[model samples]
Target chain A: MIVDSNLSFLQYCSNDELKTLCDTLTHDNKGEVRLSEQLTDNDVYLRCYPDNMKGMWQEIAAELQRFGGNTFANIFRGGVGASYESILRDVCKKMKVRIPSCSTVEEIEIALLTKYCEETIGSMDIDLLHELSVEIGIKPQSYNKQIVAAAILVALRRGGGKVLAPVIYYIGSNISRILIGRGVYLATAGVLGRAAAALAGPIGWALTAGWLAFDIASPAYRVTVPAVIQVACMRLKHNSHFLTAQCV
Target chain B: MHPADAKAILALKKIPGFNYLVRKYMEYGGESLYRGQNLANHVKVYEDNFPALYRVFKETVTALGIDEPELYVYNDPYINAYTYGETRTFIAISSGAVETLSPDELKGVLAHECGHIVCHHTFYNTLLYSLVELADSFKGIPYMLFGPLVLALQYWSRRSELSADRCATSIVGAQAYQKVLAKLASGMKSFKPNGKELLNQAYEYHDIIEGSLWGKIQQNCQVAFQSHPQLCERAYEVDRWSKSCRYRQSRIRVC
Candidate 1:
């Protein structure tokens, strides 16, 4: 007659009833549960439960985040923090939830706690609880092979953003710089042609002469053309936007 | 002898799931000295690797109601942690465990192990360890595959996690323990976890957790393959417990 009095969930077991339940559980042949890993550490539950409850587990996340985490630095230093048992007992006490007796630590009180959270807190508790349920062993999860697949996808995609991006930026900036330099080159050539025209005294003949000599060989042309070309090159060298388009 | 009904194991072992693996992995003799030889290589190495963990160990004994004991350590990738010894209780920490948890999360880990200390869980743990080994050694193959044997061990393991979670909540705030749990849940699932999503997962899985055999089975299956509760599961439960009315009834349950 093993019966839980306060939890409100009841089951009456006769010898045969007990035998059937025991046999079914022991030899269920359920490959779902792993053989090696121990299940002793899973005894967690909602503080107290009600048959029907209101709010879904909305604040669960906030609760987890409340205490936050310590830096790696802190743990190595062996600074202060309370023990797990004390934490469990204290939390239940503070929340005004019933603390289980020593007898209960080895019982199904854990499930009751989880149920309470789900029924009362609803999706939030479930969502929050999901974070606690490990993928292996007994929780209901259809082990997606794709997590590995996704990880593979992510791994394959690594460094693409950084590596390919810069190459494109360099090329595009140069291209844009060169495109913009066309106007400057043409204007300078015209100016040289006009000046040559004045020096040679004939408009058409002087223009041809300037085109052949000053515009082609003069220091201004040498300096300006190369500088203009370099401005395009500099834009190519420094401009992030042009670099961005190429990478994509 | 009833596989599920180990009076000694239930009374003695501190962390819940200890019996199952200790029983299963009983290739070595059941001598405390067997673990003793492993101790120098085991516990001390972790102490050197994680200096802060050693400090936590010292502080736990100094804590009220605690009597110090010798420490032990083992090498395993699983996330199991515990405390044991007769009069001098010291905590055993694993390298895999050290690598997996954050410092605060690690603090929760240590504190939970400490819970076994003051509660006299180590003595029970020693007792249960023998009981489980006896059942397995005497009963042989059928019992090994039997569900009752599996269930008891599973139940114990899950309970141990809760005890530890309580330990953490007591030392820090329940919030910190929850945060650590949430992280464990997330880490087990997708290796990469956004903090909020992990919290959300902890809440989502809250429904199936139960204290009964079926619930234990579900919980067991949930954690059988895992070394610890899913981070979200740990976090969410911590949150629920911290804010829980049942939890509040216990004095100093939260920091």
Candidate 2:
């Protein structure tokens, strides 16, 4: 059985195009039926000459061109049957599914499915499960469990992992803020160093040097020292005012 | 440090995975690669090459009490200046900026870039710039995944500008700092900006941004992807600081 796990190319392909390709690949020709596992678990193979492999690739590329145009089919024009081999490798890594180098496409698919299903089920949020159940028109009280189970099975079969949209958004937004925040602290340190140097001469210089050293050496000090200095300087000013009043 | 920067830092520390992100950024070799590319494209400015600019740069660094960084001048048409590099920091100024700005204004620009070094924004800025470039290529990857990271970086980048503006104002006077920003906005083609008018424009801009929600939103959107605030906002910040006791006290008599 020669299975092409070039299914990843279908991500860029439309559903109607995928159906046509699947139908053409699976269609019986002279008792040689090449079935897609996505459509069926039926074990079948195309009986053809080794030299005919190139012809088969040309056929597939021609079929792909109907949907994806020349650029899409151009990727496989080099007679590389495994057009999605790199994408498969990435998916395997992401899903933590291990398949031996010599393993069949069926073996890779099964391993990927098993791992993906396990992860999706294990990490499925209760709210999401409930939402999925409701969205599928299942009664939340009676058919909730069945709906969730069916959805998980479908998701596994469809090769869809848990959507990490929220997590991605949070990280993206916060990372920008964090970087900005870091810049702010750094700027604050510079301001403090300048202000201290101006106000107290040698003592101020000593304080500024200490702050800079700490800021350079430790990220924590960089964050803390600015606020501390701001408050301390304000207090010191207040105290000086009090001292001046007493002298008068 | 500016009060705003202190506030921003405090807000940033609360974010989860920030330390991890910083660690990953530090570990990335993209910055070094970028520096290598820059070294090839730009001319390194030294005492022998650009004596005046180099001297001014040195004076700013000395005044700020920071280690001297390499300076590069690139023949770009855009009137801008930036600093990059991590292990060995470098400041680059566009020829447009030098040609357009007066010596005093150029001093402010150099001082602003130096401020980034003093504030330790150099390394992170390089990392952020690299990440943004990467994000540009990988469009399928949701911005939510790395978008906020870039946004946060832009946020920091913008705030750092404010800090840098303050640094510039302290080194050169408020007038030169304001002129640099005005010149950056309206170029030196035909209009020589009056210092008082530019200052008033900054104040008017401040009022617009502060007075209405629509103005505030416009301001935010305007600076969303920019590394620096609007020239008016920056000019306003510098002008405001110039009048403050802290600015007066910290203002250095530069050579």
Highest TM-score: give the candidate number.
Answer: 2
lDDT of 1: 0.41
Query: What would the per-residue lDDT of candidate 1 be over residues B1-34, giving only the tens digit for each residue?
Result: 1112233344434446655556444434443543
lDDT of all predictions: 0.41, 0.55
Q: Which stretches of candidate 1 lie above 4 Å from their native place?
A: A1-248, B1-34, B45-50, B72-79, B85-88, B124-150, B186-199, B206-233, B244-255
lDDT of 1 by residue, A178-238 (tens): 2222322333445653453344333223222322331234322332222222222233233
lDDT score, candidate 1, position A3: 18
Would you give the TM-score of chain B in model 2? Answer: 0.89
Alpha-carbon runs more than 4 Å astray in model 2 = A1-248, B137-144, B252-255
Per-residue alpha-carbon lDDT of candidate 2 for residues B108-127, written as tens digits (9 for 90 to 100): 89999988887777766886
Question: Candidate 2, residue B24: CA error in Å?
Answer: 2.9
Question: What DockQ does candidate 1 have relative to the true complex?
Answer: 0.10
What C-alpha RMSD separates each model from the true structure?
A: 34.3, 27.8
